[model samples]
Target: MSDRDEQAYAGTAEGKGPVRIDEELARHLENKREELFEEFEIRDEFPPEVLREAEERAADPEGDIRTELEDRRDLRELTTWTTDPADAQDFDDAVSIERTDTGYRLWVHIADVTHYVAPETAMWEEAMERGNTVYLPAYTVHMLPPILAETVCSLVPNEDRLAHTVEMHIDGETLSHESIDIYKSVVHSDARQTYNDCEDRLEDPDAPLHEANSLAYELAEKLHEQRKDDGSLVLNPKRDRAHTIIEECMLKANKAVTHTLQWDRGLEAMFRVHPQPTPQEWDEALQEIQELDGVSIPGDAWDDPRKAVNATLEEAPGRQLDKIQWAVMKVMPRAKYMADPFGGHHALNFEIYGHFTSPIRRLSDLVNHWIVYTDGVPDGIGDLCDHASDKQKDGETCERIYKDFLQEVGLDPHAVNNRGIEVVDDPADAEYTA
Candidate 1:
């Protein structure tokens, strides 16, 4: 559920509940969501057993997490931090890095969700049923209950949390993996930084984690440059520094884990396979783009459609972005989850790719965590892939419908997405910025 191609349909995150709307509008919104949920067979409620299990695990996270500290790597001394959205609820991942003489030592510590929601647990069953978290502008239907994410699984600042860390020694000159290690560990996030905070720190020399943040961006920029140079299609090339940092880090870490699973272990797990557009499809898409007003496809980039679209996007008129994206989307096939890493990921130009981040939200990551932990493949992985793929498409469709409904009710989906929603008795009583 990488959904990097998401700009094709929608947006990103930060959570503060809901935007202020009157009761009538609120009722309408709720009804619409209900309709979408019913239509897509989305389960918004956890069974009683699942909720009780989550509650028990959440009741004493400190005690539970403390019990496992004996055998795990103690990384509390590391200057680790999480960078998420302004209103993020649970931080599932944190990063720490050091510049080595030969390369950079990067550590990506993810919430050890599998520790609490193991294969035989009620929570695991519920998560598998949900497939992935469904996010609709101001609301989110979580795969795992909020209790687990809020307590045991969240990498909250200043809290010692169990983690699955992916440690990589990346060669500075080659930007290639010199070495990679994945292990269980204990991590203490020093701070929870918003994307804006990351940007501010990058500019402030005296700020805490400034040097580390700068180093991260330096490495991130290198990774990004290398990715684009390798013929990766960046639908949105003008992404901010903060987004770039997370994107590159996660991509590299995911690549590292899947590469190990496929090449080293020869295991069948959840792998992402993105099909490339045919030459004719690419030509037609390019022709469509070229025909658009204030758009041009460079002569040199024609051979690589990915590069051509990327270049066009970087220079194309802002208003025509949706059109250009639509053209490409029409020609491209939907990326799907597979038991094997074959055909690769086309948009990313990655030979092997899979999910290992955001286990709280994505079933694929959760399943991969189990695979890596037990060296055991899930039964019927191919069927599971189809279920995940179908559920993902369902979530996307539901989100689109929800957003459309919001617009019809005189609300901005973007505003609601960024600011969240609040239900009030009367719309006039609610204070709003715009």
Candidate 2:
């Protein structure tokens, strides 16, 4: 190798330096590693039978699609599109909008993953076992194999992919069940855009896909206002116009699907439930908030904690915002998948909610799809829900552990600022200095 190449590789190569890991950090890392494998299988390879079925379906994905022409709308000609992260591989959902005489007709198209992976199949069982995709910094463990998630079942641009659509006729930006219909659909996405571009073009009058993008922005604004009015918490730090648009669109679709499965069909399915915190937990959360922000909340704040939390966040100092939000979120109970339908989502302020958007990565969504199509759930659904909920927690734990390791090694995963702490020579006397 050349001298320059050797110099470039010296400090960067794997074995060039002796990495120092202190005893405390080392023990924590080891414990986290054990917890990871104990809770998650980390399975990546699919069985031969499952791969064979996926390949067969990929070849003729829509040959045997069972959408009734009279019932299901033929929306392939509509100007539909998807917006996601720049690095996203699986395109699971799309949106289309048009102005009607009464109001706006909005179409949310979700990829019909269950149409490919049927019930009681090997592929279906594997998906249930995986529960959902576990995405780490290095790699992703997809719930469905990549063959389907990245290629066939993904709602790619200009491709006619089968979908289960929620068609809503909005008058003045409100969604009513009377004007919404759920049915199978065939969609051809006009284009695929990224979240960054959507944000950039939020007000571009002549931007590509201007009509749909503009309408989506208006609808999302209304929905966001409604959510705030209904006492929903806005804890996400990265809330923006583009993010709000996509979030509201997905929320509308998920709410519609859940309403159909629970209220219309009365089918037994897994619901995404978020229970309210007990009085003790609420007291603890309030205590943490007071400790962080030094702002005392009223005793009656528990009645409408969303408003209290958001109001406190506005007054929270800039430097303490991140840590304060983290502490507050740590006190909140985790949302889980449940078989019961009546359990409401406390966070979203929904009376009923279910995972119905990304069947490509979530088994809970696939179960919802199965219920939609077959009008019944497969055997062992209760066990599947339990496993999925556990795996979801495991996935979060694994990501946290991995991110911690990355942060210690001077790599901030979010990349907002440099988090490189200085290392003391004694190893035992490690401390940070400006």
Candidate 3:
């Protein structure tokens, strides 16, 4: 017999294994091979630009874009004029302050992403491929090339960068603001600060930070508390399972964007909104809550929708709120791309809320900023949204396929067990045995 045939039969002849490979085993092996090939592709496909940028950053971390902007003395350095960028490399959004006849004027400057990531540039294509930056447990997969995302397109300080600015007139007492205008403009970030540091400085006068930073911190606090009092939801949703520390930066950035959109732009943009609970779903959620006794609903549930949701969630600690929210989300129509002149945000009970930040990370926000700022729309804003949605779906599928591949390779045991065929319903008893 041929050597290959001989080897194939050796195990069977020794009574150590099956005589032939089974279909299931063959399929599993094929999946494992495919997974290894994909891993190879990922490694090989690592963008050369990103690698170069990483090397440059490694060689001179301080020379990186974030650092340069933070050190600049232009508008970015003036706390009274503009707040620091959220992250050092963040070039997308900036907060501006002005003394108005009424009290104060605040403007949020957002990067005009459509200006650079036109229809199908290499950076735009890469961003589309990623759907969004994926913050895995150990690493991050950015949606755009680092050169653009971390530098040029970023809303860095000191440099006169282009932006879609949203100006607002604030009533200092209630921390409420009326949108004044949304238009393209130029900005220079004076500083770069993280939420923790900013919050600390705001709470403690002795904390070392720019003097103007204290004012920004105070304003942010007033706005935060005002939103809570104004019926804004404040459910601290559970994070993804494979948590990453970098996500905190992203969350803070998201909050910054939300604040800018709601307080400055005044235009209603698509939001990740959650409707009030329906009777049926609320009942089920309540049942689940009752099952776990000793949990109390928050006292202020009736006063705020967010508080109410928090109260329901307080009944069960940990992921109970997240799971319930997910269930609630499933019952509602998903928030999608749309144009609304009135600032109608049902969940927040606001007339205006949009996403104008994170152009470096999200395609939708990038596109939205362009539409609101520039006089004319980009080549294909509608098509871009459609394509972005498709790409997002495709990425999700690829993730699922990769997880299955890992299972086949014995790298993810939980995945394998989870995929086992589930019996939906039992057939009529016909000599059935447990």
Best by TM-score: 1
Global lDDT scores for all candidate models = 0.86, 0.72, 0.47
What is the per-residue lDDT of model 1 for residues 1-434, given as tens digits with 9 covering 90 to 100? 23332331233444445567777777778899999999999999889999999888778878876888889999999999998876566677889999999989999999999988998889998898899888887687888999877667989999899999999999999999999899999999999998878888999999999999999999999999898889988887767888888888889899999989999999999998999989999989999999999999988988899889888998999999989988988988998999988899998999989999889888999999999999999888999899999999999899888888888878888778777878777568764422
Residue 317, candidate 1: how far off, in angstroms? 3.1
Deviation in angstroms for 268 in model 1?
Answer: 0.3
Better of 1 and 2 by lDDT: 1
RMSD after Cα superposition, model 2? 9.4
Clashing pairs in 1: 18-420, 18-421, 18-422, 19-420, 19-421, 19-422
Ranking by lDDT: 1, 2, 3
Query: Where does model 2 exceed 4 Å of error?
Result: 1-39, 62-72, 173-175, 291-302, 415-434
Q: What tens digits encode model 3's per-residue C-alpha lDDT throughout 139-235? A: 2345766655666666665565656555666666754545455555546665554444454555666765544454454455555446556665444
Candidate 3 matches the true fold with a TM-score of 0.58
Candidate 2 lDDT over 1-434, as tens digits, reads 01010111111122122234355544554465556656666666778988887887777665544333445667888999998765466888999987777667788898988878987778888898888887654346688889999988899997788888888887774545347788888888988887767866776878888767888988878877787668777665346676777788888888888888887888878888888877677667767877764565555455687766666666666776676567567766788888885768876778988878888988888888888888988777777788889988888777777778667755444331112223345656543211
Please give the distance, in angstroms, between residue 143's alpha carbon in candidate 1 and its true position after superposition: 0.4
- Report the alpha-carbon TM-score of model 1 versus the true structure: 0.95
